[model samples]
Target: MVMDEKGMVMNANSDNLPKDCPQISETVNLIVHAGQKYATKFNGKMFAFDQQQWNVKPCAKINITFINDDQIRHQFMIHGLPGYLYPDGMVHLELYGEGELKASLIVPSQKKTYLVHCELAQHAEKGMKAQLKVGGGDGDLPNISAISSPIKMDAYSIDWTMLKWGGMVILVVVTLIFVSGRWLLFRHFSRRK
Candidate 1:
């Protein structure tokens, strides 16, 4: 039993405590233990343990320190988020070179469920996925067995030339329309004069 700042008795294990008990203004420290052995056989998934899950309130600012205990590289990524609130719609922490990787992020005030997993290959599909309960989660996240197998292919490749050319085409079209409209208006006025 731990006493909150408001002197209220909170059963540390109980999840049904009052929401207004106290504002958890202090920074919360989270440790994500990683290793290659935790990888699942289902396409070499990573972080196989369910104990890797983490949950917290919406307004809390968390400091996550990932300690890599394995010889291989590991990653911590979150998904299914509002991109407007969190850029890239995800938070990626890679521990490829070893040592420890630390990062901090503040959760949005809206209550929602988010997926945390390793994005390397078939990590999330195997067992590297966990549920984060923001402001309270929507029950338990889908288990490793419940997740569909990842498509075995490279999905990150993008055609930079196409993207750049598409943007330039749009810009040129807009500029031409503006210039043509202005030229027509000027010619009409000059003829009337």
Candidate 2:
């Protein structure tokens, strides 16, 4: 882990290889940015990673340059790694504000998708979520902004009873206005006569 006044890179592995993998298959360099502007592409999202998904070969070494475009705390964390190599099975990079940090991690040979997100309260739920897929991934994780459906979707149902009542009320109001206007016109003409 490397720390400075700007940001910190925690549990990044550049050299170490997993037990199932004899050597690194490839090196993937990813430039990921985090901020509100990135979230603008996604409606109702407050924060997000630049990309929603990534795919790499098995045992591929990933070098990530995480850029925080906003002047606030943000993180790029990958979960579901081997705990022996990565303590807590996570590679985390955090920026205190608008800055960038470079880090690396190696994925295992198993075909799986790792969850990448910010640990801040409601950040992932708000949209700072992504997927790192090794070998096309086992499957898609739920609620990966624009990628898959949310685990729990929002329900919006219309009440027919309320609709009927509202329609009747509007019809009555319009009829009363038209009748009153017509009656006033007739009364004016009669008075003039």
Candidate 2 lDDT, tens digit per residue, 45-141?
9999989999999999999999999999999999999999999999999999999899998899999999999999999989999999999999999
Q: What would the per-residue lDDT of candidate 1 be over residues 103-158, giving only the tens digit for each residue?
A: 66666556777887777786666576766777776655655434433344446778
In model 2, which range of ten residues has the least summed lDDT?
A: 151-160
> Least accurate stretch of 10 residues (summed lDDT) in model 1?
8-17
CA-lDDT, candidates in order = 0.61, 0.94
Q: With candidate 1 superimposed using the best TM-score fit, by how many Å does residue 191's alpha carbon deviate from the native? A: 99
Clashes of each: 0, 0
User: What residue runs in model 1 are displaced by over 4 Å at the alpha carbon?
Assistant: 1-26, 37-46, 145-193
In model 1, the Cα lDDT at residue 129 comes to 74
Best by lDDT: 2
